[model samples]
Target: MSRDTRAVVEELLRRIAEGDHERTAELFAEQLDWRLDWPADGHPAVPWIRPRSSRADVADHFRSLSAHHVPELNGTSVARILVDGADAVVLGEIVQTVRANGAAYTSPFALHLTVEEGLIIRYHIYEDSLTVARALSA
Candidate 1:
């Protein structure tokens, strides 16, 4: 039986929320194409927000996030999900506390995902970069 694309996405989000990095990586293709809609040079300011091309890189992205921010996973919520065939758009908010200065980084996020053969092939995320930068740099 083929898995529902929506279900696959929801499960991946669940794993992320639970801080199950290993399981989250499992849901991604071997050569995952992950990107944050931000300038590559901004990586110096926000290490987690960078382009990644492999599952290990994806895990490194989250590890960078974990090192820098304390995410309020309970406050994260998906406001909407729109699916078309293998493509999905998720609109949501992520609440986090910058570990450096204890500033809150509550920002809206729009995520685009493409699933193939039950694995996520593309993960493109757009978020409030300015807000996040200010909060983290504070």
Candidate 2:
């Protein structure tokens, strides 16, 4: 028996909210089609905005994100979640204070996830990369 798309996505979100990066990765497939809306050249200051493929990389991404931000000041407000069959889209806004420069940035984000066999195989995140990049800079 396989879980529904909403259930899978909700679990993933819960794990992330709890700051359990390693456990969150368990909700993903061994190999994932992951992408973040950032340039190929990548921002030298933003460490988490990079290509990720395997489940391990997924955990790494979240961990790196947390490492660069002030955890107490980091927050996400999810406006809605839309689900159809195997696809789920999460609309939210993220707020974070950079640990490096004490800079804050807010970015509206759309996360598209495709769940199959209770595991997320497709993960694509669209967010305000420019805002995030600027926040990371001095």
Candidate 3:
């Protein structure tokens, strides 16, 4: 029996909210589509705002994110989660304080995940990249 898309997405969110980034990566497929709403060049100051490929990269992404942000000051407020078949869309706002500059930024974001056979095959995120970039600037 395969898990539904909503269940997989919910589990992913649960693991992330618990700050278990390594476990969160386990929800993704070994080799899958990954995208962040940043430029191809990526933000010079934000290390985690780059591209990811495999599940290992996914783990690195979360680890880098945790390392760069002030854990106590990081938060997310999900507006809604819409699931249709194998697709799930999560709408929310992310608030984070940059560890380097101590600047906080809040960006409304939409994350689209495609789960198949209990594993996430597609990860796409759209957010205000400039706001995140500014927060990382000195």
Candidate 4:
């Protein structure tokens, strides 16, 4: 039996975590639907990253250090990946070092994804907004 959409999506996320943009982008449907909770701040504000949204939004969110080029994502560990039919939940932890203030913080995140017809239809994210602010201020 072929892997289900959740499996495919998990694999896709793995590729993105390793910085495989091209392959990551290929997994999405023609017009992907993306939603983000973090403010772009001084970086590229792509509110809705569609048709392969998660890949770009993630990359931009990491790279956009603004005033201080913070430590490039010290470490990230995916805690869980659960698929309930077409919907999936991904929980992970991210640690980063702030360049300007020389501070570090670890934040937990949760991503809810819905895939249909082998394509990502919806992406919802939940993270600590204050942690992001502190890191940026650093």
For candidate 3, give the lDDT of residue 43. 81
Q: Which 10 successive residues of model 3 have the least lDDT summed? A: 1-10
Query: Which residue pairs in candidate 4 have backbone atoms (N, alpha carbon, C) closer than 3 angstroms, thus clashing?
Result: 32-51, 101-138
Clashing pairs in 1: none
- Give me the runs in candidate 2 sitting further than 4 Å from their true place: 1-3
Best by TM-score: 2
How much is 69 displaced in model 2, in angstroms? Answer: 0.5
Residue 77 error, candidate 1, Å: 1.4
User: What lDDT score belongs to each candidate, Candidate 1 first?
Assistant: 0.81, 0.90, 0.88, 0.62
Task: Estimate the TM-score of every prediction.
Answer: 0.90, 0.95, 0.94, 0.69
Q: Which segments of model 3 are wrong by more than 4 Å?
A: 1-3
Residue lDDT tens for model 2, 22-76 = 9999999999999983897578988888888999999999899889999899778
The Cα error of candidate 1 at residue 87, in Å, is: 0.5
Q: What's the candidate order when arranged by decreasing TM-score? A: 2, 3, 1, 4
Report the C-alpha displacement of residue 138, candidate 1, in angstroms: 0.8
Q: Give the per-residue lDDT of model 1 (tens digit) for 20-99.
A: 77778888899977778477755467878777888887777776777787665336789998898898999999888888
Summarize candidate 3's per-residue lDDT along 36-112 as a digit string, tens digits.
83888688877888888899999898998888888899788899999888998999999989888899899999999
Task: In candidate 3, list every pair of residues with a backbone clash.
Answer: none
Q: How many backbone clashes does candidate 4 have?
A: 2
Q: Of 1 and 3, which scores higher on TM-score? A: 3
- Please give the lDDT score for candidate 3: 0.88
